[model samples]
Target: MASQNDHFASIDIGSHTIRLLVARSNEKLEIYPLRLERRITRLARNFQEGQTLKTPGIRESLRVLEEYAGILKCHGVSDVACGATGVVRKAGNGEEFLAEVRQKTGIAAEILSETSEALLSAKGVLSVIPRTEGYILSFDLGGSSTEFLLLDTRREKPLWHTSVFIGAATITERFLSEDPPPLEAVSRAVEAIQDALAPVFQAIGSILPAPPTPFPLQVVGTAGTATTLAAMNLKMTDYCPSRINGLPLTENWLTATIEHLVRSTLALRREIPGLEAGREDIIPAGALIVREILRGLKQTHLIVSDAGLLEGLLLDLIEKKYGRPQALVSPLTWRMQKG
Candidate 1:
C-alpha cells in the first residue's frame, strides 16, 4: 500500500498537447493531485502527409519533456509513467522520437495502442464518476483521435470501446482551408464525420439496441475539447476543473456554439471569453465533432469531465504500486483492478 505523501507522476503526450500530472496518495486511499501542466506542441499537425513526426514538433515536445522531468525530480516522485498516443502511434519515426525523449529527459515514454487508449480513458472517467448508473457513453476527443467507451458500472469492463482517427487536428488538416472555414469546408467536415461515425454506430448497436422510444443514456465528455466547450458554455474567464466536473452542456448550446464558430474567423474566435488562446483555430472542428457525436448518440446533453487519460494513468500507477485494498473499493472496481 502507498504510504502517506508518496508521490507518483504520469504524462500523456498527445498530438495537440503534452500533459503532465503529479499526484500523491495516503493510506486512506485518497489521491491528491500536486501539479498539472499542459503545453500545446501540435505534434500531429501534418502527420497524415509526412508519416513521421515533424522536426519542429519533436523539438517542442523534447523541451516540454525536459521541463516536466525537472519538476518530477524536484517532487522526488516515487514512480513516473509516460505514454504517447495518436501521432506517435501512427508516425513512422515515433520510436526514434521516443528514444530521443528518453535520452534527453530520462523519461521512458510508452506508445499506447488504440485499444489501450480506450481502456485507460474509460478507467479514467470511471474513477471520477463512480456513482453514475444506467447506460453511459464516454468520449475522449483529442487532436488526432477520438475514443469512445460504453460504460456500465455493473460490468467489470467497458461494454464496448473504439477509437477513430477523425479528430480535431486530423479533420482540420484534412478539410479546413480558410481562416473561418468556408461553408463548403464545414459541410465536408460534417459529411466526413458522419461517414466515420457509421462504423462506430454499428459497433455500438451490437451492445446497445436502438430504443424505439427515447431513454435515459448519459453522455460523458472528457479531454480538452469537451472541457473547453464546457468552460465556454459556463462563460468562465478562467478554467476551473471543479466547476467543469459534472457540468451539463445542453444540445441547444452546443449547436449554437458550433454555428458561431463555423461562421467566425480564427481571430474572432480567439476573442471568445472561454475559448483557450492556443485552441482558437482548432475549436471549430472540435466543436463540430462534439455536436455530431451528441446528435448521433441521440443525446440531449453531454456531461463534462475534467478527469481523463492523465488521471486514469495516475490511478493505474497507484493501483499497481499499492495493491487495491478490497475493503476500500467496490466489487466491480475490484474486478477491473484484476485487468
Candidate 2:
C-alpha cells in the first residue's frame, strides 16, 4: 500500500489533446486533486492519409509528456498510469510511439481498446454522479472517436456500451474542408454523423430504442466537448471545471449555439470566451455531435461531467493499492417501478 501522503498522477493521451491529473491521498484514503493540465497538439492531424501518427504530432506529444515527467518527479510521484485513446489505437505505429514515450519520458502508456474504453469512461461517470437510479446515458466525445454508455441502475453492468467512429476532429477532417463550412458541407457532416451512429443505436436493442426513451432517462455528456459547451453557455473566459461540472446544457441551447458556430469564422470562434482557443476549428463538429446525440434520444438536456477516463484510471489504481472504499459508488442496483 502507498503511504498516506504519496502523490499519484494520471495522463490521458487523446487525439486532439494530452491531459494530466495529479492527485494525493488523504489520511482517510480519500484522493484529492493536486493539479490538472491539458494541451492541444492535434495528434490526429492528417492522420487518415496514412494510418500512423504524424512526426510533428509525435514530437509535440512527447515534449508534453516530458514536461509532465518533470512535474511528476517534482511531486515525488512515481506511480503513474497513462492511457492512450483512438488516435494512438488506430495509428499503425501507435505502440512504437508509446515505446518512444517510455524511452524518452519513462512513462508507459497503455492503449485502451474500444470496449475497455467504454467501460472505463462509464466508471469515470460514476466518480462524478457516484449514484443513480433509472436510465443514465453518457457519451464522451473525443477527437477521433466518441464512446457511449447506457446504464440501467437496476442491472449490475451497463445495458449497452458502444463506440462510434464519428468524432469532432474526424468529422471536421472529413466533411468540413471549408472554414465556416458551407451549408452543403454542414449538411454532409450531419448526414455522416447520423449514418455512423445508426448502427450503434441498432445495437442498443430493447429497453432503450434509437428513436427515444421515456421520462426516466438522464443523458450525460463528458470530456472536452461537453465541458466546453457548458463553459460557453456560462460565458466563461477561462476553463473552470467546477463551474462546468454538473451544469445542465439544454438541447435548445446546444442546437442554437451550433448554428451560430457553424456560421462563424475560425477567427470569430477563437474570440469567443469559454471556447478554448485551440478548439475553435473543431467546436462546431463537437457541438453537432452533442446536438445530434440529444436529438436522437429525444433528450432536452444533458449534465456535463468534467471527471472522466483520467479520474477513473486514478481511482482504479487507488482501489488496487487500497481495497475498494465503500465511499466509491457501488454497482448499479436501481429498482424500476412498473405501471
Candidate 3:
C-alpha cells in the first residue's frame, strides 16, 4: 500500500537467551540483515510454572537490551518489534518486567502467546529450508518450553501446533542434576521427556494425514538447543547461520552426543568444539529432549534451522509496514541474494 524502505529491529526475549535481529527492507520486499546477535541470560533460570521472572535474569536482560538499544540507535532504527516467549508469557511478573524494559531502553516488548510463537517460528524455519516435503514438523526448544508446529507446504496455515512445559533447562533441573550425570539420571530424564511428549504425539497422529503422497514428514529444529547441537555436529568452532540451515542432525549423532555429554563434566563439555560456554549445564538435557521428540515421531534426523522467532519477528514487521508482498523474500534467500 505504501513504500517501505527503512531499518527495523526485532528482539526475541526467550527463557534462556535474548536475541536481536536488525534488518532493512527493500522495494522487492527482501530483508537485509544489518546485525544478528544472541546472548544467554537464562531469563527463566531456576524458573518453574507460574513463577516470577528472576532478579538476576532481569538485570542481565536489561543490560543486553540496553546494548541492543545502542545498536538500534547506531542504525537509526526507531521502529522496533519484539516478542517475548516461554518465561515472559508464563511469568506472573511478565508485564512488570516488560515495563522495566520499556522504561530503561524505550523499547516495548509484546509477550507472544505460545501458539503465536509456534506459528511465527515455523514461518522462519520454513523460510530457510527451501523446498521441503509437504509435511513439516518444526520444534523450537527453549529454556522453559518447546513448541511443535506441523505444517503442510501446500497449506497457508499449520495443521496442528502446541507448546509444552518441558524444555532444556527445566528438564535438567528436574531430572538431570549430576555433573557428568549418572546413568540413572540420564535414564530418568529420558523417561520423563518421553512421558511429557506421549500425549502430544498421540494428538499429532490423530490429526496427521498420510505424508506427501509417499514422502515422510520433514523434521526441523530451532532455538538455542537445536542450533547449538547443529554446531556441535559440524564441529563448528564459531556459530554460523546460513551454513546451519537445513543441516541434518542424525539420530546416531544425537544419541552419541547424549552419551558423551552425560559422561562429561560441565568443564569438559565447554572444551567440546561446538558447545558454547554457558550451555554446558543444560546441553545433556537438551539433547535428550531432541532425542525423545524424534523417538516419539518415529523420525530419525531433523534439519537444523538457525532462523526462527528472531527472523520471524523481522519478517512480520516488514509485512505490517508494506502490507503483504505479491511474493515474499524469505530471510535465507535474501541473505543469499545479498551475497
lDDT (C-alpha, whole model) for all candidates: 0.82, 0.81, 0.86
What are the per-residue Cα lDDT tens digits for candidate 2 across 1-339? 777777878899999999998887744656667878899988998788348999999999999999999999988885888999988988999999999999999998999988777777777777766466778887989998999888887776777787777678998998885787998999989998888887766665465744444437788888888888888998998677767768899989988898899899999988887898788999899998888888777678999988878877777666666665532342312111210
Which residue pairs clash within candidate 1? none
Cα RMSD for candidates in order: 4.1, 5.6, 2.2
Which is better, 1 or 2, measured by TM-score? 1
Tens-digit lDDT string for candidate 3 (81-146): 899999889999999999999999999899999888998898788777787556888899999899
The global Cα lDDT (0 to 1) of model 2 is 0.81
The estimated TM-scores of all candidates read: 0.93, 0.92, 0.95
List candidate 1 stretches off by more than 4 Å: 210-215, 325-339
Q: Worst 10-residue stretch by lDDT in candidate 3?
A: 325-334
Give me the runs in candidate 3 sitting further than 4 Å from their true place.
Answer: 1-5, 210-213, 325-333, 336-339
Better of 2 and 3 by lDDT: 3
- Rank by lDDT, highest first: 3, 1, 2
Give every collision pair in model 2. Answer: 153-334
Model 1 C-alpha lDDT per residue in residues 1-339, reported as the tens digit of each score: 567778889999999999998877766667777788999999998779348999999999999999999999999898887889888988999999999999999998999988778777766776666465577888999998898888665566667888888788889888885787888999999999999888887787777755762435788889989989988988889777878888999889988888898889888888898888798888888988988888887778888888888877777777777786221122222111210
